[model samples]
Target: MRKSRAVMGNLLPFIIAIIFIFPIIWMLFVSLKPQGLGISNPLKWFLPPYTFTNYVHIIADFQVLRWLLNSLFVGIVTTIITLIVTSLAAFAISKINFQYKKFIFIFFLIGLMVPGEATLIPLYQIAQSMHILDSYIGLIVPGIASPLGVIVLKSFFDSVPKEVIESARMDGCSLFRIYYSIVLPLAKPALASIAIFTFIGSWNNFLWPYMITFSDHLYTLPVGIPVFNSNYSQDYILPMTVNAVSSIPLIIAFFFFEKQIVKGISFSGIKG
Candidate 1:
């Protein structure tokens, strides 16, 4: 019984992984099928008269590279800004003593309960008032206010030994110096986890960018791919091809940062 349970535990991850990865695999397979063909039959999906025609057409016709660059720009900028803002905020909440600090942290915690979709209208109005519409500033700015990053980083920051912070203070280190030199280094795993989530979220973000930007040139990959699909609505394979292309960056990011992601989750689970 014990051996069976242990084997099942070991096998569980592989089973879960396959369940998650299967859709992406199916998407890629369908995208590889000849352009006009639909996957109405599951058996015909693998028996592909496979071609790169859809990829070639998408690249030639659409602003795919431009859309990719736009997404990369937005994702990178959003991640950097979120990391900076959330880390500072988290450090202050976790380490600094201030009036109503608990209230402030609780406020951020409340932000987690508020669904992002609920804020779209107000966020749009704010962006409009700022006149950042149809621009990268609009794309990148609104996403920086991440409550999740704050919560994760604060949990990690709280785990940092108070003794080290006091020792730094006794050494005449300022709060900024302590944060920059000591706390930030200790919170690398949490930071990595936050960064990955922020970048991926920004990359996959569609609604805000779609609603804000009117120009085709300003469209991110997620937004752009859908627009392309709208024009070629009858053709199924092209949309899949574009989706497959768009997914490449995220897949590469996950694989490269797989260890950091695991470490971050483990550390957060243990510390938090």
Candidate 2:
């Protein structure tokens, strides 16, 4: 009976996953269908004749390309910055003994607990004051130091054996040397997880970027989707196709780091 319950629990989630994926699958199908295909029953997407008109047209659309490039740049920059800031902070907090270290860690963790909306107005005002509105720095700077990244990496570091760090220190390794060479390599799984999270957050960020970046050229994927849709006259198929393409990198990252991703998340919850 216990085995049966475990099997049911496992199988139930798969059923739910398929149900969730149905809409995405349908959207991909509709993107393939030409404008003439009847959408009265949208689920009957496979019945229509397939064409690359939508994909080809979207490819020709310059704004989508521009938005993609902007998002790619911002996301890459944000991810790199977030990883460095968070990792160094996490490493210091985990491995070092400084006065008020706990206070500082708690301060950074405040970012994780609080919703971004609470800080949006102030962040906007600051951006305006600094004349960074519509600039990449305006979008990227605010998010470079993630509280969750610090918390996640800190947990991973806590799991590392202390002896290794001691040995490295005895070998005349500086604190930064030990952190970069010894600690980070063991926490590669956590780093992979952090990079994925940072990339996804930056790629999908619309509200903050929208609030700050007024220029059409600076829009990221989420904000860009709406702009593209407006031009398409609510012809969602083309925009959704472009969205699917943009999601490919995120999806590929998940696929490649599936194991590390799972381990990094689940085990991080288990403290030393």
Candidate 3:
């Protein structure tokens, strides 16, 4: 019975993975279908004289490459800024004993519960007031100080031993030196996890970019692909093709960073 239970446990994840992955697999097949072949009929779905024209056309004519670059820029910038800010804030909250530390940490936690939609109007107004609308700054700045990133880093930072920090201080290391040298090196797994999560979040973000950017040049992949899809909806295969192409970066990111993500999340649960 124990052996059987182990086998069942191993099989369960594979089953769940297939269940989740089937839709993406189906979408890829559908995207490969020849133009003018509708997917309305189940039997006809795979009865395809497949072609690469959908992908070819999107790359050749649409702004997919540009949108992809925009997303990459935003994702990279947001991740960098988030890491810097959150690392500092997290170091302060986790390491430094200061007045109102608990209050400040609680304040950041409150930000996690507030929905983005609730702040949309205020954010929009602030963007307009700052005259940064339709610019990359508009897309990048607001996302830098994310509460989730702060919380994650703070948790990881808190797990660092107080003795090690004090030892470094006794050895005449500055706070920034300790943070830069000791704490950050120990927190590599968590940092990698946060970088991947932040980049993915920024890359996949549609709503904020949609609201902030007024020009086509500023549109990220999630925003641009949908508009392109709607414009070319008559060619049913095109939308699916765009979606498949857009998902490639995320797949590549996960393939490379999956180990770090798992390690980080696992290690984060350990008490200091």
Best by TM-score: 2
lDDT of each: 0.86, 0.81, 0.85
> Pairing residues by index, what is the TM-score of model 2?
0.85
Q: Compared with the true structure, what per-residue lDDT tens digits does model 1 show for residues 39-143?
A: 677889878588888788777865887898899999998999999999999999999999999889888878767789999999899889999999999999889
lDDT of 2 by residue, 1-272 (tens): 99999999999999999999877777678778786444777557777588889878777878777888888899899989888888998999999989999889778867666777888888788889999999989988998855777888898899989998998899899999999888999988788877876777788887888888688877877888877777775556776788776776777887887886676567446522
**Local distance difference test, candidate 1:** 0.86
Clashes of each: 0, 0, 0
- TM per candidate comes to 0.81, 0.85, 0.83
What lDDT does candidate 3 reach at residue 225? 83
Per-residue error at 243 for model 3, in Å?
A: 0.7
The list of candidate 2 runs beyond 4 A from truth reads 1-16, 36-38, 41-44, 260-272
Summarize candidate 3's per-residue lDDT along 68-135 as a digit string, tens digits: 88999999999998889998999999999899999998998787677778999998998999999999
Better of 1 and 3 by TM-score: 3
Q: Model 3, 227: alpha-carbon shift in Å?
A: 1.0
Off by over 4 Å in 3: 1-19, 37-49, 259-272
| Collision pairs in model 1 | none
